[model samples]
Target: MEPHAPAGRLAARAHLLAAAGRPEEGLPLLAAASGTTPAQHWAGVPWVADPTLGPRIEPGLLARTVMRLCTAVGDPAPATTVTSLRPYLTVVRHAVDAHGEHAMLLGAGSALARRLGEVRLAVEWAGRGARAQPSKLGEIWLGYAYRSAGRMPEALAALRRAVAYDPDDLSVYADVAATLADLGRLDEALRWTELALERDPDFDCVVHTAHRLRHRADGDVEHLVALADFVRDHPDDAHEHTDLEECCRNAAWLGGLPSGTPLPAGRAPVNAQPSADALHRLQRVSGPAWPHPPGAYDRALGLVLVEPWELLALLAHPETARAEQQDGLEVWACLGLLHHGTDEPWLDSSRRRLLLGLLDGEVDRVTQAALFAMVAYAWVDPEAREDVAAVVAARLTETASGANARAVAELALAAPGLDRPTRELAAATIRVPAAPRQRGRGRSLLRWRRD
Candidate 1:
């Protein structure tokens, strides 16, 4: 075989640095070797010059590789490795044009671009995916990409198209509700949340959506009370940890925090100007989450005063925070507030990586509690539940304290496909409330809509 190209050599060195615990130093190198621009990466490639380039990549091989790469990246991806893989994949993207799962590939590309805060690239991939063929995943991702790009009306239309594709998929309803809430249409959003709940009350997406919307609209302790009601109804379930802990944390702050604060008017997604990097997309999904230098109302919901990552970092390193910043009551209450209620991309990679790293290392009680409360929230997509469940269960065995242990145990039990031993341990440790009998489905849609 020929010796590696200089670009390949540069990429290899970057990966070596990351593997050696010098990830910060490696990031720039990896980004550089990838050429830092689509034009540079795709330049002179036969596939790019002509869609008719001969000898297309074997469809099955390309699809499987792309999917495996997706799973490997996970939340809080191995930063340098992911950065390197991205442009390399883009160069070969058109090579798999004939693949049956080409649409999925494009959707995955859109996701990577979105994570990097490249709004136009994200939307472009989604559009290509949707144009490649009409697919449920394609449409859902396109809707999501549009939402990220601040094209609210188009996002809604695409998401509704997804609903039209499969009304039985409860999560889609929750997505619709979330987008409505983004537009400050709480009533319509709530109706959609209820629509999902009536179909299946246990749905996690709707549950998170309901909590977020209720908290934003009511702007009171009542949202916390509502979460308490759910926790009481299903005590051992880990799915409630984020919501439950948030409620408890907020209840602690109700006395000190001010109320009746005026809120900024909502902006029209349509009127937003385009930028080269699309960093505005980041500001939209969850506003300037770290530092939150503007304080309070700067957050999307205005309920929590501190960024989730900042709270975790402060809790993890109280020695670094000032006396006043240490407790961060409002921060604790609002940790994961913005992202927990939504699906992927909104949660973002940096936050996911930080939370996961904290879970493995030592931290104070407050941080540990925060970690247990929000980990599952980051891993919100039901499709990835198995991986998230494994992560929670492994953490459960290592932790044997009371508060954090119970939270971890309950979270582990709540996950689907958990092993028997993990379930037994979680159940044996505490007395969770008996699950209420499930309500009958097939309720009147007309009544729900009219109400």
Candidate 2:
């Protein structure tokens, strides 16, 4: 590549640095390129010139470069960096109009808009791209943008259009299934999830969704069987540890295993250790906030929070668990909140301490009780249960100003295995009624019994 060739020096340097595992060093060059006019940036590139002169640029090179820079910056490029890409988006738009609707430019613009927290702009650009090209890729972006914006109906429609355009895209199938599941159409979601698995059974997200969908759709135990089978058959697969751990959790919840029972054979042991890299990846993905739209962020957060327990469960050695506890507590507390009505037998004293700390933080009292209730029902120790219940009851009283808070408190109290005193305290706060039993068809039976 010539020193002065279009994107030559910059792209070459960036590629070399990236190949050397020093991609961060190339950011300055990318940043400089971002500031240049699009035409100037492409000036010496062979493709932008008349073909007779030299080799042309590859079809998607420019767009790919921008995407590469964005990715290199981080999973989510800094908001400031994303904001800085606006000029480039303008250039892409100009190129689209000048070149009679280039799909790449439109798509890139859509992505840029989304990254910059401009969902409406993303929708507009993606829609234009789909209209221009009528391709599955364009439609996929349109659907994704719509979903990110919380426009679920439009998102579903666009995703369906993408499916019509290309039934073979397993990612689209997974997205469609997830969207349907979010809308409470679990049966339809299960069908799409199965289709996704049929296309690519090895994809972790697809498999995860299929299992979740099956559980939701009909309380089927098939997903557990499939997970066990996968673990037995593919022990060396990269995802084996996580998958097996999840299988154990589902087994406990769905199969009614008692607390502390050994998982079935071929399952990873509760003490199975996770690598440092895996833990780091989890924290990065599930950290305090996401760059996505709020609804999407909440959904992603809920999934991430609920998932780490299996991994946490596997780190059973007390010292190891303690060392990792701080890094994982946020996830656990969030999980407690999400699993409000569900029992999690994994909560121990250390984990409970982590949760108790959250109460002293900025979180609302009622939300804190709800989270505590999740942990409370899981406590096997009497003292721990009392402590958790006391916290819940106190928070319930403190938040007595809202019916919502009281309702949440009642739900927490309804969790099985509370002591009588805690139950009485809850009863004092809310109307606790007797458990009703159905009467037999017994007017004649009562008369006969009397006789």
Candidate 3:
């Protein structure tokens, strides 16, 4: 009984530190404690009795806390640690049985799995819980896991169940609508989005959904301009920034065609098409600024950064024509290259040039891994292949975080440094849940394709 005392004290301190807005300082201590701690005990679950001690925290609390710390720490090892912990189902089972009041613990597990990029595992745990007991919380989680895994129909079904259980849960409805739109079921998606907005007009997610739908349905330039205006006014909301970015991307994709107007750039010119070299050049232009990119300089100063994926899309946009346009363009190009997956020639002539550009600048481990993954995917051309492989090998040996860590693991498998089983497991980590009928076509867009 007393054995839990020391750990409890440390855990409390960690929690206090995190709560006090000192997450950066609190994270390492949490990680050390997490690594030293054994799997949590589910049996002999005790309720709060000690007046001085307060309520007893669940054994699995460490795992969940460790994950939150990892997010705060912004390191790759924490994600790898969570992935490594996946084999032990008993740990999760114990937590579920012991912490009846802490359903959030189960939600945390599902979220952690998703964060580790283990979409299938995320769905599996969340789905099982939903099946076992159809609580509103469980249903909402099941829907999210399904959405992340690219199973749109299943996600909608789960969301419907969740809404039926509690129609007031605007968050669940917004998520469901988003997934529906991703699957191209725009009409249905719009309806659900409307339902959510009707319930809570100021809901952030609902606002985002309406913004996205307007672009898709009406391609309203005025609406996009308004959204951009709103984002500038509400700079603190990160999601708003994402919405504005998407609006910009949509505008570029529309390529000046009027709203509700037909596609104008329907055909590529004989030589004007996006050549392999042109694509590569466009991607490379994004950058390796010493002070980091213009808008992201402050965020970069903080601990372990995973280069934002949205930056790449911005680079790919035609409207990104400023001198600093390279900041967004290159990142967007990288994302497209990533979309090519690890087994194709998507990188080809264009990708190599872009990678070279990135190398020439001050790219970090995460960006390097992203470039390496693209090279691995475009595994053709002996000279380029060697260059990319060298980059990957070097990068893998050093530190990594976020998607880069996963990319590094994949590189090891492709190059022969990592063992077969570990490599397969890593690949499995990103494998999404079984695709539902509606989302089958969009599967490639959602998951992190190989290489």
Best by lDDT: 1
Per-residue alpha-carbon lDDT of model 3 for 1-451, expressed as tens digits?
1333464455456557656755434433444444455332211122111121112244345345545543432312344355433422334444555553455566656665665567887787787666666698888777877877878889888888888898787877777787778888889888987877787766776777777777677644334434444544556763432554554432312111112211111111121223344444454434432111112212222211222223233322334344554333433344344432234453445444444444322233324334533433323223344555555555544523333244344434333223344445445633533222121111112112112
Each candidate's number of clashing pairs is: 1, 3, 11
**Cα-based lDDT at residue 218, candidate 1:** 58
Clashing residue pairs for model 2: 6-44, 6-45, 47-57
Cα deviation at 341, candidate 2, in Å, is 38
Model 2 error, position 440 (Å): 48
lDDT of each: 0.50, 0.49, 0.46
The estimated TM-scores of all candidates read: 0.42, 0.42, 0.42
Window of ten residues with lowest summed lDDT in model 2 = 442-451
